[model samples]
Target chain A: MGASSPDLIVHVDTFARVNMVYEVLSVISVIMLLAASLAVLITYNWRVCVLSLAVQYLAAFWLINLDYPLAMAAVKLVVGWMVCAMLGATPVDLKQPDEQLPGRLFRLLASAMVWILVFSIAPSVLQWVPTGMVILWGGLALIGMGLLQIGMTTFAPRIVVGLLTILSGFEILYSVLESSVLVVGLLAIVNLGMALAGSYLMTVSGGLEV
Target chain B: MNAPLIWIVFPVIVSVILFFLSARRYLVVGLATGSNLFFVLLGLLLPIDRLIKLGPWAFEVSSTLMVFGRKFVITDSDAHLVVFLYFFAAFWFFGAGVVRAHRLFIPIGQCMVAIAVAAISVEPFLYAGLLIEVAVLLSVPMLVPPGRRVGQGVLRYLIFQTLALPFVLYAGWVSAGVEANPANQRLLQQGVVLLGLGFAFWLAVFPFHSWVPILVGEAQPYVSGFLLSLLQTVVLLLMLGFLDSFAWLRDFSVLSQVLQLVGTIMVASAGIMAAFQRDVARLFGQAVILESGFALLALSVPGYQGAEVFAGFFAGRLLALALWALALSNLAADGISFGFDHLKGLLHRLPLTSIAVVLSVFSIAGLPLLASFPVRLMLFDRLIPEAVNAVIWVMIGCLGMLMGGIRTMMVVAHSQEGWRFEERLPPAILMAIGLLGLVIIGIFPRWIMPYLIQLLDPFQSLGVLMILPLI
Candidate 1:
């Protein structure tokens, strides 16, 4: 059970185990992030507001752990939490219909996660062992997550689905070690542009409570 | 100044200049269109690596412009292709000026020109996926109908493209190993599979083709034409670029087989779908999707002859689709219903639109002595010998498409009696262009083929050259 024990049944080395743990933590953090993103999207619920920021912080923590081992995981956590806290203090009820609330929240979360997958998760895949397999698995996971969110919600899921699909592509890009800095940078800009466009769409549709 | 850099920067600069001169609509249109024309001219005139540096930034005016880490490198082989992209963009910008809300037209038009320039200039084996994502994103606003269906086709398109990007990216990534001559055939296999998936998505091959019809249904006719015809032309070149630049891809028999299979399915399914399609826009979408598959299969076949045929065929498709989209959009704007029941007796009412549609359909159907004929013959001739089953599939599909065309004509012609002929006819210029282009290409296929062949000579190896005679 100890870190040095080769006798441990798992084939993973200490670093690998640490990476795996971080991966798990990353998944959990992503789930939380999705929840918070969902909440922020669904309604500016003051009661749930604190949870949203806390989740974003947790996501940053786990994501950072996948790389710079000593890198502070709490940076994103603290930042996300702070944003959430501010929102919680003065909750803005999107005040949209209750029936439509979940769908909106799901879509927003899906979009936010897509960005995270691109800027954060995808690049980190480069650091994993068996790089291609890891990248492939990561892409499949992101795709699965996106689909799950889309299937679970009825709102304008196209925007989120599109973004998620794009992230899945980023995952594949990393798997192939196509770490073309220029390409990644260009994709980043495109993703943000899409997010802006998607937001504009929701606003236009009367889906965004604000 | 670097040709590639100037080519890209000029558009952005022009767009900015035009954005400011919104008060003078015609002037802005003229400026934008003129600048786009200049890009086309530049694409034709510039050397592959013409570059201008402003401090740390390097600019090129071949295919794309690089600014502050932005690198646009159009190879000599890709010069003609880049020029074609700019030409199409210029054409669309001219059309944009005459329409209302030139806002969408200006920004997306400029962005598409940039994307095309980037697409053609970049090292094809390296950056196709990212370029595709950029193009798709740029297309979203245009593809989705305003305030309706909430970006249905755009979203589908985005997802399908996203699915495809990884495949091609991974293929390129794995093929990079070919430089080192990786010992593992498994690596090669993985790369081929990824590429197959990628091209299928990019081309809207069957089963992954839902986006095509949906996009046509939702998008404006003009924008749809740009995306399907001009954008697709560049995309075809990008795919061809992979084959030219990457020996691994050109040599992969398995990958070639997958393309053949995909093409066969696309042609058959699209034809079947079109026969049943009630919506005119969707019918166009299906036809285009099928044509795309045919083009993809043609290019994917392993040889110089196939690639050469693809280039000529693609140019023809570009012209055909552009004319078709213009005519369709004109009809849509005139409150012409696209449904079968609604289109009855339409031939008498709109002579020009009817002629354009008929001509375009003939070209698409690969009828004798039309633009698409030589391309189809080249594709089926090569592909049939390899996979007889695919040939049969395509032949059957061709029949379906033929019937679909007749069905469409019959319905539209029948609907003409009830409605009055108050609406003005579509511009005669576009019809003439479509008719002339197809007829000229059909009568003398070799006229354009030789030039395209010469332009693409750098891609032809001894092995590929050997296959040309065989094809």
Candidate 2:
């Protein structure tokens, strides 16, 4: 389809007032997104990071479904899970030592600041983008938190996860505005490519250590 | 076969095949270079939608290839660009042999050319941003050699390039809104801002350019040069395409002023920084930044003159960079660090490579009898009448670069009385040819003018400016 097609409209009023079950699931998903994103930012544990990344994607799948079709939403979940798997496998293949937690207080302070900023400006962002409240707050929070993670860390895997989180946030907002199959397919390729490059970088670093 | 199929899919298929055969470096390089040359020949000989006589064969090549409801069209008007890109790829591949870069460079570099071409040719061209990102991703492994730790430069490169994606896509989104509501000043402003930011990041203008010097410092000089050359060319073309596609953007006087201002800053700052740089790799980086500054200057020119200036600057840059990078690569292979101290007396050992490196620097500095001199002279003549301060600052930048080149030459030539020139035949021949090409082009600048003019044909509104009027 041409990118300019007007058929892909978002009925925000109806979408925001979906059935009770979806509403409950969305609430649960938002909480999961926030908690997992916090975990990713605050901790250096590979296991925790991987699990949190997976949970974040699962939550993304539920929230994204509000704006995109089932198939399109599923693509996000599948790609996210695949990326999680690849990132999770790297530390194991390398037999990496447990990472020493550094600057816990600093991380906590930064994460808190980001969360506060995102929540404070969410209403204005919602007005600007005109998407649903759920997506506006959730996507913005993830994006802000991801930027913090990326800025604070030099570790390749952490940076990769941060990139993924940022991309996920964008995908959520973009899904609300346009839903061309071609764009979706291209995004999927991009996600997979990032995952693979991240994995290779981690491997190269691991080999250097040996 | 359609032009898209020939230019896009065929290269991709060949790339994949070359990937498996990458163990044989010579074979991969030969095949990749040969394929690129074949495409150049094809683009020159075949007329789209018209029957061609080839002895026992007569057939017309189609221009459009539709897939997944999107069209990739390469018309006869695009023949010059097709040949330019392929010839560039071939030149890069051929130089890869001299540098002995990793096998992945050939295959991945070939794929990059195809994807970049597709990015420009793809309809609903916003998708070009995504394709460029993919090309960036593929470049990572090649940039970070195997078993080496990934440098901070590569990471920064990734972040900055990724950062551009959203801005570009959003611009496309906002553009749709502006198109629907042509009278909305707010929407027009928003679209213009997003596009400006997007191309700014993509082009690595002054502030966003922290990655260029760093990447050059850490990676192989040859590989980094190839990456810089390819990315800069494609991104500049993409920017031009954006301007061409949007009348509001092209006619915005403020944008031209912004281009001019940014170009001036980049040139002035990069030149000052290059003069103080001790490391040769960083000096090369400065040269790239300077080249990009000239490109932005060209874009700032009024009317179609900007396009002409851009074409000349782009062609000159490719030759200058190839020569510089090849010499740097040879020095690197000889266990030579790019530091001034380390390079002292090196001209005694590798006279040919040293001469090639120094001449390349001088060419970039706009010395007489070199490839870049004509382009620089044209840019100066055009700007002096318009902005004297700009002309003075650009001259200062060029002078700084010339000083840097002189410093390098002095250090390299610091040799004992009994010093001897000893070099392998291949590199010697390559460097000689490179030096000769630079001088010949400098004296006969008009030899390349036809091709540069042809590049202007795609933009119908960009009339043929009096580029190189004296010539």
Candidate 3:
């Protein structure tokens, strides 16, 4: 407890706060991803998972509000939710080892992986590419994600895939043009509306099943 | 911007609330139909100007009006199409309500309204694909049987539609990118191929046409009619919009030729299939496919008149088909099969229903004074010149359609000596409307021409005069 140590303490506290912010955002995103995954696994008993994931998704939104990088993280959470939920609900166990089906599934997985990789390295990739190429890359990546989701057996997945593709295309376009928050906000609203619709269909379809 | 949009929105809101209230109950059907009728009325009364809004993000509404500019035009031509679609939707929706529980009808109708509005209002006009897909999905429950086939038809329908998305997106990309040349030769070629394939898929053309019969064979007749007639008509309107909005599309001779080739193939194949079909429902399905082919063939003929004729023929055929499907569905109820043998004594057993069937089948066959007769004559005239050396193919298709009609009439007209009458005739209103439509449109072909021309104008250049001077 010397007078000189107070300045050092203050510096350490600021550094810790920055680390805490990043850690919290990262944790929030991971939890969302996990929750989305769990929703897919127990989709037969979907209401509880849907409700839980929806809440987790809201918390993720708060994380993104506190930290911008977490916004990009939300896309993965949604995709994870969709893909996992689809796999959980599908009668994949009884299905044969048809090459076409497995090939499609593998392609979907590969596409998702490729998209995530692309997004992870997008900042570095941007430095190497021209504006048009950047837009093209971003669009293709989002589209790939969409295409993957669409390839699934379920209707909810297909609808979600369509919305995601549209979102990806819009996001790429936004990035290329450096669009204003208003456009982004509207786009987010549209995406959210689509998600709500997809969720509603899942509910109705659940009734159809019973 | 127009008050009628309010009319469209308000009823939808009310119906949605009602639908939720009904839950899994039958009340949803009535509320949905009532709401759909309200939407139809809005379309009928709303002015074109009031129906459209022009801005960065525009919305339009009106009663008996034309709201938007020439860039996104909705002339008097759309009146009949809209009116017919509304009533057709209402009729089928009500019929479906009576027979089945389709919770999607209300939402589907709303999507239809959105599609119609978007088609009437959008610029460069390629956005219809997304809206149409939405409509198709909204129609899923109606296409497949509720219990066992709960998701199959809709699933297949969805997959087929998904296939169309990329083709359309590619077309849009091509159109957007190919600006230096208004018509991109390669892009146009790609577009012609893609659109021809895309529409053929939508229309269930030939080899890819399995979905049509499969759906009709399984779903309730009312649902089948809505898909075949009302929903299909909207898709046709969307195609018309695309051809109308883009000068480059209309200018491409290759595109027209492709449409002819596809249309010809479809007619020939579908007609042959229809002629050999044992299922009555499937016969009707095949008949729709053939009619769709004829429409494509008519669209292939180059000239403003050809385009106008195509529009008129499409509108007329849609009305006829809707009536036909409605009658056919009722005829099939009570363990009815599509086989000729099953319908052998339909005349004596179900006289009113038989008559409704007769009117629908005959009208579709282009019987004189029926709604479709004039349209077919006009379509054949245009298609014949384009067929050149292959003239007989078109003839065979037409003849096949006629033969199918004759077969249905012959089968339904006879009464078996020992057969007992059990099934009662459907309500008189359906029969009266079908017969009246047949006779009125057949006798007075000119009655609907002006309105048809107005609808066609957006696609082609039209003159006010009845007959056009050579360009």
- For model 1, the local distance difference test gives 0.63
Candidate 1 per-residue lDDT, tens place, B107-165, comes to 66677677677666665445757776776766666555356445467666766776676
For model 3, the stretches where C-alpha displacement exceeds 4 angstroms are A1-210, B1-4, B21-84, B94-107, B145-148, B180-184, B413-415, B418-426, B457-471
Which of 1 and 3 is ahead in lDDT? 1
Error of 2 at B23 (Å): 1.0
By summed lDDT, the worst window of 10 consecutive residues in model 1 chain B runs over: B462-471
**Decreasing lDDT order of the candidates:** 2, 1, 3
* Candidate 3 CAPRI assessment class: incorrect
In model 1, which runs have C-alpha deviations exceeding 4 angstroms? A1-61, A68-141, A151-154, A161-180, A208-210, B20-25, B48-71, B97-102, B145-151, B415-426, B454-471
lDDT per residue, candidate 3, B1-471, as tens digits? 443344434544664575466455456656656766766675566655544544666654433323232123343445545555556556665665444435555555544554555445444455455445555655654454234333444444655654564455446545654445664476566666667666766777767777777667767766666677765666676776667656677777677777777788877887777667766777778778877887777667766666666666754576666666766666655667767889887877766667766666667666776787787777666666556644467667767766777787788777646545555434446556667877887788777676666555444442323543111
Q: List, residue by residue over B1-471, the lDDT tens digit for candidate 2.
A: 789999999999999999999999999989999999999999898898788888999878899988677788888888778888999999989889877988788889999999988998888778898899899999998998786678888888888888788788878888888778878887788888888888878888889999898998888888899999999999898887777777777777688888988898888888888888888888899999999999999989977777777888776788889888898888888888999999988888889888988888899989999999998898888888888998798888988888889999999999775567767677678778889889888889889876787776566655653344345
- lDDT of every model, 2 decimals: 0.63, 0.84, 0.57
